[model samples]
Target: MRSTSRTEAFPAHTPAAAQIFTTVLSHGPLTRSEIAGRTRLSAAAVTKAVRPLIEAGYLVEDADDDARQPSLGRPANPVQVDGGRALFIGVKVTGDELIAVLTDLCCRIRVARHLPLTSRDPGAVLASITALVQELLTEADGFGVAVHGLGIAVSGDVDRAAGVVRYSPFLEWSDVPLAELASLATGLPVTVDNDVRALTVAEQWFGAGVGLSDFAVVTVGAGIGCGLVVHGHVVSGAHGVAGEIGHVAIDPAGPPCHCGNRGCVEAIAADSAIVGRIREVTGIEVADTAEAVDLAHAGNPGAREVYARAGDAIGRGIATVANLLGPERVIISGEGLAAYDLFAEQIREAFAAAAFGSAARCDLQTRPLPFEEWARGAAATAIQSFIRSDTY
Candidate 1:
């Protein structure tokens, strides 16, 4: 286990300090006035919050001749977060693989590694995670900065406050105290969250969801997942589980879900679901989702029909989200996008058909994010926990 004896607390603990830091990290190199304007804090407050950060080497000011405002009697030099101030580790666990990355404080991936998982057992997965983190920690030694925190992204009902994996269908796990175990093993403060929500945090601060007050991230792969951002905040719901559109039942007569439900979106659209349906319909003895896609791409009518149905289910599920929350955009992503051509039209058509009047106007964007990006998203959560003073 690594040592936490050298762990340092954030320079400032006030809400404004965290807010200011996040603003710079997201849309940075801004002057004090601009920070105040964007964060809705007074210039005095922004200055107060920025001082300790600058002194701590977390924020650095850069000369900007073009930003000089002589009329205001200020240079308007911009301040930005120092990406090298510290490092972090993020791990994204799938049923069969582990993706881990070493990241700077700005959530930029400095180094990454991928390991195949031979088992989905909690203990086995934890051991794999411990090994990967140790590898990343060794990489961090070259940077001469402490790895402040570690974040683990798992697919399931995760209680961030409790640091537990309440249920993970993909891994067949229940009530696993993943955060506590990971922290104990790696000797770094750990933040455990739903994979989709973790990815949403990264997007909200750095990726597609940036500058948007409301957006949704819909991931299609081994399982379908959704992460929601409303009014600039990622919604975790009162129970710590929200935006589970995959379980939204769209057809009562449809296939059964592992969640013990019928006609759920996941049952119809998840990678495993699609593969199984393709096998049933085409009797091609396909081994996995890749083969299923190949069959569809090769113009197998049965395989194409299966993808069409899955796309419809996914579309209807997205429509459900739009009808309920009315987000500005829906980002569709994940490893499954490799076969997006098979059913892209069906998804759009079904969404357009089911979505309410104005809700149908929501933009649907496709982003093909590899597992490494998902690992980076996990790192973003660690950055978030560090900034909020939740992981010391």
Candidate 2:
């Protein structure tokens, strides 16, 4: 538990201050001028905002080392976030397990804990999450910093503003008020967001999407999910459902989806979909994605074809995203990348065939993000909420 007597608040309250601080947090050790440039704020505004943060110990200016001085004798003192100033907790809930991480103000993971879930009942999951939070909170006590906030990442349709898990197919959940329940149980301000969007936040701050204003994160595994960042903002559409690439129906005659749609991307490309397809095609008793991948690697033509078809479906989904958003880059990640060798060519080929002329130019890069990184993304959202003063 956090010490009740230790009262602390972020110094800068204005939006400009939050923006400046976030710039420094993400791209710092940046000079004041660089912060101003990146944030497009006036130098005076940047200085004004940075002053309070620096004074409050959230931002730190580097020492005036002569070696860092420019040739013109101007001191280029870089400013950066003091990560140790505060702490946060992040929890990522999957159908089978709970992943939690203790992170600092700068969103660096300090400790990670994994707990297998015996049941997917909302109450059971919430209890597990509460217990995990308490454990991490006790761990934070050793760091001597206040755990300011907590963020929970859930899959499917999550209403972040309302702090609700609208639906999670894997967990068979609907309209679960997770954030409110977790906050009440754990005594910490909570931010609830879709798992992929939370990961996008981390990407914007520290991963492949850094320095790119327009990009998409396409994750392939249990479900085909996408997170879109347009004009430097992660889009959460008016209806609390945005970038749902998994439901894009590419083949009407294909498999039926749990969302009651036929031939949706997830129905064809997700892990279970691939596993089932391999079983049907090869008559092999593959238990999971690993066995399916192994069959393809062992020169099973039918299994390899199944992966190829899944890749084609995923590529078409990526093309749809590119056609609509024209993102500068599309980052492919998730556990499914373990079988990337089997599907890489098919994905590229299908994407090229499906993408429009200019959209085809979009860079497609593969990045392997582990479950721990997804948990870190949840922490990033907590840090985001804390700095922006949207505590809950």
Candidate 3:
């Protein structure tokens, strides 16, 4: 376990407190007046909520000379999250390994650990997580702070409210009580979330999607995942699944997806599909996505064609999102961006061809966020839960 200075709990545990904290978090180092203004909360309410926060150390008052303003009653100082007051652990469970990190309240990484997994069973995965959390907790010990929460991110259909991994194709898991088990093992509050959604929360607050009211984070890699933020909130469908663009059928006769659907974008454009199709078309016996990317870069006709088809599929999928939501931007991301050079043009062209008139105007930008960012996303979810629970 990592060590840190044990700080007091957040003073305001109410919903209003959470709201005020988040407002300061996203747009912090702002005076209480500024906080009330941005959150649209009355100054009285902000004052009531912030006093305890300052006392608890979850929020701090900045004493910088230049930032001081006399007219603001100079009565209030700018408040920001005390990144060092408490610690949190975030673990991203992948098919092959668990990536864990210890983060401060501001979600900055202090330590990172990667441990390979030999089994995909719930019990086995939990064991790995428990061990990792213990190690991080020990590390937190040195810093003299208590680890406040834990966040785990998994792929597939997850019931966040239930804290269960309802379905995770990558891990071959279903109905796994991951949150309860992790919390039991670590003796800390646990927050479970869909990997993509967790990543979306991070983006909403700290990454490329920041400051955008409506945007989509479309990931292309093992699976084609899309996270939609509508009017500044991530939409989790009633059934706990939303933005499953991978299952979006783009070609009815193109390829078969594991979801038992034909012509799904994932079936046609996912990394596995691209690699497998390249082998069928070129008879080159490609081993993995890297080999396939190399073949395409080497100017092999079949490999290039394979990427073209995947790009076309992605474009159509993106167009569908634009048509449905009318978002202001679509941010393309994920490991598949490594092959973007081979398919960028195709993705753009196909998106243009498929988009409806007005929908086509939304900004289309691509960014490559690594797994570390995804792990940071897990931290974001914990922070969200910590703050949103009171108000929501």
Candidate 4:
């Protein structure tokens, strides 16, 4: 694999420069005045910050016939990130598969690959990740741009700052120094983050949460997860475990959770929980979420009830998040959205019933993000790290 032994420093040295560059990346081609307005920076500051980025070929100006001429006392040329200037690699690790993507500086995915996992062991998963990165790196060679960094997203208690997987329930891992391992294997700087938080970064930069300073992302699937962007920053709690809506215990007398709790949101709504519940309630062998969804769609009342319960659990989880942080919007995504028809009403009703006074007004919308997007979210983190000089 082609690797850069030397770190490629981003030209934006100051926070203001990074902020301005990110503004253009997310909402460009935009005029300098627009960047200034969005970033709340002065026009002069935007110009000063943008110059270095443009000189480094990370930002480019476009000609507009209608643009005001600088000689006329105004600069009206719009600027945008040069997507082809740099490349990045992202990998999202799940219990059964790994999803990887190659993205440019703008976080636009150029290639995507999925590989099933034969084993959940750290070494095996790391090998798979390395192979995938090598494939994407070869693809990057075609574009002739160095792959600046790699970001790996995993579910559960990931300590991003320490680059450790404190615990991942699905993979049965704990305190695995994943970033260092991957960096050594691929010879590329790596950023490790929680899967949902990684996806939240993508949303903040290019998806639903764009232009919003406060929002939340709630994902329901193999595990229930939440990501919060409060005051324009992704909230990683003091213990690196914020927005963990999944483990919130809602019922003391209900289903037992793997976390040694009863009726936790994840225990009730996660895919495995729903599937197990369906089997126990209906006395049928449902192999996976797809099969369970089919049974529910085929008018199996028991199966439908299982999904309804799952939905209620999810809705209550969302309401709890809203009542606490009071985000302006809550985006519901993940693989579990496939069965939305089975549980949509329950989710809405439960949320409405549980949400407190003004919290009920928070907008809740469903966006079905494919697995590939989660991988791209991983890529977004790499882009963020590259720009902010946080690479491993």
Residue pairs in steric clash, candidate 1? none
Best-performing candidate as measured by lDDT: 4
User: Model 4, range 83-109, lDDT digits (tens) per residue?
Assistant: 999999999999999999999898999
What are the models' TM-scores?
A: 0.97, 0.96, 0.94, 0.97
Write down the lDDT of every candidate, Cα atoms only. 0.91, 0.90, 0.85, 0.93
**RMSD to the hidden true structure, all candidates:** 1.3, 1.9, 2.4, 1.4
lDDT, ranked from best to worst: 4, 1, 2, 3
> Model 3, 126: alpha-carbon shift in Å?
1.0
User: How do the residues 1-392 of candidate 2 rate in per-residue lDDT, one tens digit apiece?
Assistant: 34332266678789999989888888989987888789999877887888888888998888774456543343378889999999998898898999999999888899999999999999999889988988988898899988888899999999998899999999999999888988888888889999999999999999999999999999999999999999999998997789998999999998999999999999998999999989998888999999999999999999999899999999999999999999999999998999999999999999999999999999999999999899899899888888887865
Taking the tens digit of each residue's C-alpha lDDT, what string does model 3 give over 101-207? 89888888898899999999889999999999899888888888777788898989988898989999889998998888887777777899998899998888877
Instruction: Give each model's clash number.
Output: 0, 0, 26, 0
Better of 2 and 4 by lDDT: 4
- Pairs that collide in candidate 2 are none
RMSD of 1: 1.3
